[model samples]
Target: MVERCKDAGITILPSAGPVAEMFNGKKIASSTRARDLKEGQYPAAVYVPRADTVERFLAPQSTSATAPSRAPHAILI
Candidate 1:
């Protein structure tokens, strides 16, 4: 996503977070994280894009939405 944005001349900035060290790569299109599954923990990733570059995506209202924290294999960057 970052690459696509940058390729299109968008300025992308990595947002400050606890995992600053992982944010080292300029080609990093998303941030990865460890998550728990039914049997164990494993790594997963969340995609991040420059806020100014992406088009608006309307999502369904998550009335039955589980909390983001419950995702065993995906976490926010």
Candidate 2:
């Protein structure tokens, strides 16, 4: 499915207004420059830049995963 979506070309565009991610009652990430990505029939994903994220709230994962069409990415905790 992922490979098929990659072949179809994912669409990425700037999101309207701001985008934010919250955990518990705390804000982990917030960005006005966040991007909305849509691939095939999947739900859109909002991607916030690392610079807009709160560093104190994010801990880098020891191991990272790499997607076939994307670079290796760390899972924050």
Candidate 3:
């Protein structure tokens, strides 16, 4: 799915706090949806590129990435 996203020219920004580091950071992570699928998915971990190597990556992304508890209807994508 991630390969497909890249092939389709889709920029898959991380959806969760820990995963956001992948695009430009050393951590490998994923969205909550991915975590829920862990039982069915084989690889629990993923490889993410470091932010130091990329210019498009966002910094302190986790802070702004969070959706408010009151605004549960907000769409992250």
Candidate that scores best on TM-score? 2
Q: List the residue pairs that clash in candidate 1.
A: none
Model 1 agreement with the true structure over 16-63: per-residue lDDT tens digits = 342312333433232333111221243323234334221233233434
TM-score of each: 0.21, 0.76, 0.19
Clashes of 1: 0
Model 1 RMSD in angstroms: 15.6
What is the C-alpha lDDT profile of model 2 across 1-77, one tens digit per residue? 12234554788778888988999899989899888788779898787889999899887676655656553667575
Per-residue lDDT, model 2, residue 8, is 43
Best by lDDT: 2
For candidate 2, list the clashing residue pairs, or say none.
Answer: none
**Global lDDT for candidate 2?**
0.76
Q: Which scores better on lDDT, 1 or 2? A: 2
Residue ranges of candidate 3 with Cα displaced over 4 Å: 1-15, 19-40, 52-77
- In the range 56-76, model 3's lDDT, one tens digit per residue, is 333333323243322223221
What is the descending TM-score order?
Answer: 2, 1, 3
